[model samples]
Target: MTAYAVGQLRNVQMNDGIVDYLHGIDATLAPFGGRFIIHGGTRETLEGSPADDLIVIAFPSKAAARAWYVSPAYQVLVPLRLQGAEGDIYLMEGVGSEHRATDILDVG
Candidate 1:
Protein backbone atom coordinates (compact mmCIF):
# COMPACT_ATOMS: atom_id res chain seq x y z
CA MET A 1 0.00 0.00 0.00
CA THR A 2 1.06 3.54 -0.56
CA ALA A 3 2.26 5.30 2.60
CA TYR A 4 2.55 8.91 3.54
CA ALA A 5 4.88 10.94 5.72
CA VAL A 6 2.80 13.58 7.43
CA GLY A 7 4.37 16.40 9.39
CA GLN A 8 3.05 19.33 11.35
CA LEU A 9 6.05 21.59 11.80
CA ARG A 10 5.84 24.63 14.03
CA ASN A 11 8.13 27.28 15.50
CA VAL A 12 10.16 27.23 12.34
CA GLN A 13 13.32 29.31 12.64
CA MET A 14 13.50 30.26 8.94
CA ASN A 15 17.26 30.48 9.05
CA ASP A 16 20.03 29.61 6.64
CA GLY A 17 20.02 26.01 7.84
CA ILE A 18 16.34 25.85 6.99
CA VAL A 19 17.00 27.26 3.56
CA ASP A 20 19.57 24.57 2.89
CA TYR A 21 17.31 21.89 4.26
CA LEU A 22 14.48 22.98 1.99
CA HIS A 23 16.74 23.09 -1.03
CA GLY A 24 18.13 19.64 -0.33
CA ILE A 25 15.00 17.71 0.62
CA ASP A 26 13.94 16.76 -2.90
CA ALA A 27 17.22 15.05 -3.63
CA THR A 28 16.89 12.89 -0.53
CA LEU A 29 13.35 11.90 -1.47
CA ALA A 30 14.10 10.95 -5.03
CA PRO A 31 15.77 7.65 -4.18
CA PHE A 32 12.72 6.31 -2.42
CA GLY A 33 10.14 7.49 -4.97
CA GLY A 34 8.84 9.95 -2.45
CA ARG A 35 7.21 13.17 -3.51
CA PHE A 36 5.57 16.02 -1.67
CA ILE A 37 1.81 16.25 -1.87
CA ILE A 38 1.55 19.33 0.34
CA HIS A 39 4.23 21.90 1.17
CA GLY A 40 2.43 24.44 3.27
CA GLY A 41 0.95 27.57 1.78
CA THR A 42 -2.28 28.76 3.36
CA ARG A 43 -5.16 27.25 5.26
CA GLU A 44 -8.32 27.87 7.31
CA THR A 45 -8.93 26.54 10.81
CA LEU A 46 -12.34 24.88 10.86
CA GLU A 47 -12.04 24.14 14.56
CA GLY A 48 -9.63 23.81 17.44
CA SER A 49 -6.57 26.06 17.70
CA PRO A 50 -4.64 27.38 14.69
CA ALA A 51 -2.42 24.80 12.99
CA ASP A 52 1.16 24.64 11.88
CA ASP A 53 2.59 23.91 8.45
CA LEU A 54 1.23 20.74 6.90
CA ILE A 55 3.56 18.55 4.88
CA VAL A 56 2.66 15.24 3.30
CA ILE A 57 4.89 13.08 1.18
CA ALA A 58 3.74 9.93 -0.59
CA PHE A 59 5.82 6.79 -0.90
CA PRO A 60 5.36 3.44 -2.60
CA SER A 61 5.10 1.64 0.72
CA LYS A 62 5.63 2.02 4.44
CA ALA A 63 9.07 0.49 4.21
CA ALA A 64 9.98 2.92 1.48
CA ALA A 65 8.76 5.81 3.54
CA ARG A 66 10.68 4.61 6.57
CA ALA A 67 13.79 4.05 4.54
CA TRP A 68 13.55 7.48 3.03
CA TYR A 69 13.26 9.09 6.41
CA VAL A 70 16.21 7.26 7.92
CA SER A 71 18.42 7.08 4.90
CA PRO A 72 21.86 8.62 5.20
CA ALA A 73 21.06 11.29 2.66
CA TYR A 74 18.08 12.46 4.63
CA GLN A 75 19.83 11.97 7.95
CA VAL A 76 22.51 14.39 6.87
CA LEU A 77 19.86 17.03 6.68
CA VAL A 78 18.29 16.21 10.03
CA PRO A 79 20.35 18.65 12.04
CA LEU A 80 19.21 21.46 9.84
CA ARG A 81 15.59 20.55 10.40
CA LEU A 82 16.16 20.18 14.15
CA GLN A 83 17.64 23.65 14.13
CA GLY A 84 14.83 25.06 12.00
CA ALA A 85 11.62 23.53 13.31
CA GLU A 86 9.99 21.45 15.97
CA GLY A 87 7.06 19.15 15.19
CA ASP A 88 5.75 15.64 14.86
CA ILE A 89 6.35 13.48 11.82
CA TYR A 90 4.92 10.07 11.15
CA LEU A 91 4.16 7.49 8.49
CA MET A 92 0.81 5.93 7.71
CA GLU A 93 -0.56 3.53 5.17
CA GLY A 94 -3.14 4.81 2.74
CA VAL A 95 -6.53 3.17 2.31
CA GLY A 96 -7.61 1.45 -0.84
CA SER A 97 -10.32 2.71 -3.17
CA GLU A 98 -12.92 0.43 -1.59
CA HIS A 99 -12.10 1.40 1.98
CA ARG A 100 -15.05 2.31 4.13
CA ALA A 101 -15.34 4.28 7.34
CA THR A 102 -16.33 1.14 9.21
CA ASP A 103 -13.17 -0.71 8.15
CA ILE A 104 -11.58 0.07 11.50
CA LEU A 105 -14.06 -2.27 13.16
CA ASP A 106 -12.41 -5.15 11.35
CA VAL A 107 -8.88 -4.39 12.51
CA GLY A 108 -7.40 -6.80 15.04
Candidate 2:
Protein backbone atom coordinates (compact mmCIF):
# COMPACT_ATOMS: atom_id res chain seq x y z
CA MET A 1 0.00 0.00 0.00
CA THR A 2 1.12 3.56 -0.57
CA ALA A 3 2.02 5.86 2.31
CA TYR A 4 2.54 9.56 2.62
CA ALA A 5 4.79 11.85 4.58
CA VAL A 6 3.03 15.15 5.22
CA GLY A 7 4.58 18.28 6.65
CA GLN A 8 2.99 21.55 7.71
CA LEU A 9 5.76 24.11 7.93
CA ARG A 10 5.35 27.32 9.91
CA ASN A 11 7.67 30.22 10.59
CA VAL A 12 10.21 29.27 7.95
CA GLN A 13 13.72 30.78 8.09
CA MET A 14 14.69 30.53 4.39
CA ASN A 15 18.48 30.37 4.63
CA ASP A 16 21.50 28.45 3.38
CA GLY A 17 20.57 25.51 5.61
CA ILE A 18 17.17 25.18 3.92
CA VAL A 19 18.82 25.47 0.49
CA ASP A 20 21.17 22.60 1.33
CA TYR A 21 18.27 20.55 2.64
CA LEU A 22 16.31 20.98 -0.60
CA HIS A 23 19.30 20.09 -2.80
CA GLY A 24 20.20 16.94 -0.88
CA ILE A 25 16.73 15.58 -0.16
CA ASP A 26 16.19 14.09 -3.62
CA ALA A 27 19.22 11.84 -3.42
CA THR A 28 18.08 10.55 -0.04
CA LEU A 29 14.57 9.83 -1.33
CA ALA A 30 15.65 7.96 -4.49
CA PRO A 31 16.96 4.90 -2.63
CA PHE A 32 13.67 4.44 -0.78
CA GLY A 33 11.27 4.82 -3.70
CA GLY A 34 9.94 8.06 -2.33
CA ARG A 35 8.73 10.84 -4.57
CA PHE A 36 7.52 14.33 -3.93
CA ILE A 37 3.81 14.50 -4.56
CA ILE A 38 3.65 18.16 -3.44
CA HIS A 39 6.35 20.63 -2.53
CA GLY A 40 5.65 24.22 -1.49
CA GLY A 41 2.87 24.79 -3.96
CA THR A 42 -0.02 27.24 -3.79
CA ARG A 43 -2.75 26.23 -1.40
CA GLU A 44 -6.22 27.35 -0.31
CA THR A 45 -7.32 26.81 3.27
CA LEU A 46 -10.93 25.75 3.18
CA GLU A 47 -10.99 25.22 6.92
CA GLY A 48 -8.93 25.62 10.07
CA SER A 49 -5.81 27.71 10.59
CA PRO A 50 -3.48 28.15 7.61
CA ALA A 51 0.04 26.79 7.41
CA ASP A 52 3.03 28.63 5.97
CA ASP A 53 3.83 25.75 3.65
CA LEU A 54 2.95 22.14 2.98
CA ILE A 55 4.94 19.18 1.69
CA VAL A 56 3.69 15.75 0.81
CA ILE A 57 5.81 12.81 -0.29
CA ALA A 58 4.61 9.40 -1.36
CA PHE A 59 6.39 6.13 -0.59
CA PRO A 60 5.83 2.54 -1.68
CA SER A 61 4.53 1.56 1.78
CA LYS A 62 4.25 2.72 5.36
CA ALA A 63 7.45 0.91 6.22
CA ALA A 64 9.20 2.50 3.31
CA ALA A 65 8.09 5.91 4.49
CA ARG A 66 9.34 5.24 7.99
CA ALA A 67 12.60 3.79 6.73
CA TRP A 68 13.30 6.77 4.53
CA TYR A 69 12.65 9.19 7.37
CA VAL A 70 15.22 7.48 9.57
CA SER A 71 17.78 6.64 6.90
CA PRO A 72 21.35 7.85 7.51
CA ALA A 73 21.39 10.20 4.53
CA TYR A 74 18.06 11.77 5.51
CA GLN A 75 19.14 12.06 9.11
CA VAL A 76 22.02 14.29 8.02
CA LEU A 77 19.55 16.75 6.56
CA VAL A 78 17.09 16.67 9.44
CA PRO A 79 18.87 19.32 11.43
CA LEU A 80 18.85 21.69 8.49
CA ARG A 81 15.12 21.33 8.05
CA LEU A 82 14.56 21.81 11.75
CA GLN A 83 16.73 24.88 11.82
CA GLY A 84 15.13 26.30 8.70
CA ALA A 85 11.52 25.70 9.59
CA GLU A 86 9.21 24.89 12.45
CA GLY A 87 6.65 22.28 11.53
CA ASP A 88 4.88 19.02 12.16
CA ILE A 89 5.65 15.93 10.08
CA TYR A 90 3.91 12.58 10.07
CA LEU A 91 3.27 9.39 8.12
CA MET A 92 -0.16 8.21 7.06
CA GLU A 93 -1.27 4.99 5.40
CA GLY A 94 -3.23 5.19 2.18
CA VAL A 95 -6.56 3.45 1.78
CA GLY A 96 -6.96 0.62 -0.70
CA SER A 97 -8.97 0.88 -3.90
CA GLU A 98 -11.90 -0.96 -2.35
CA HIS A 99 -12.03 1.19 0.74
CA ARG A 100 -15.40 2.55 1.81
CA ALA A 101 -16.54 5.10 4.33
CA THR A 102 -18.02 2.32 6.47
CA ASP A 103 -14.58 0.76 6.78
CA ILE A 104 -13.57 3.53 9.11
CA LEU A 105 -16.94 4.42 10.64
CA ASP A 106 -17.85 2.74 13.87
CA VAL A 107 -21.66 2.72 13.67
CA GLY A 108 -22.61 -0.36 15.52
Candidate that would win on lDDT: 1
Model 2, position 16: C-alpha lDDT score: 91
lDDT computed for candidate 1:
0.93
Q: Least accurate stretch of 10 residues (summed lDDT) in model 1? A: 42-51
lDDT of 2 by residue, 32-51 (tens): 99999999766788989785
Clashing residue pairs found in predicted model 2: none
Q: How many Å off is the CA of 75 in candidate 1?
A: 0.2
Predicted candidate 1 versus true structure: per-residue lDDT over 51-103, tens digit per residue: 58889999999999999999999999989998889999999999999999999
Please give the lDDT score at residue 106 for candidate 2.
64
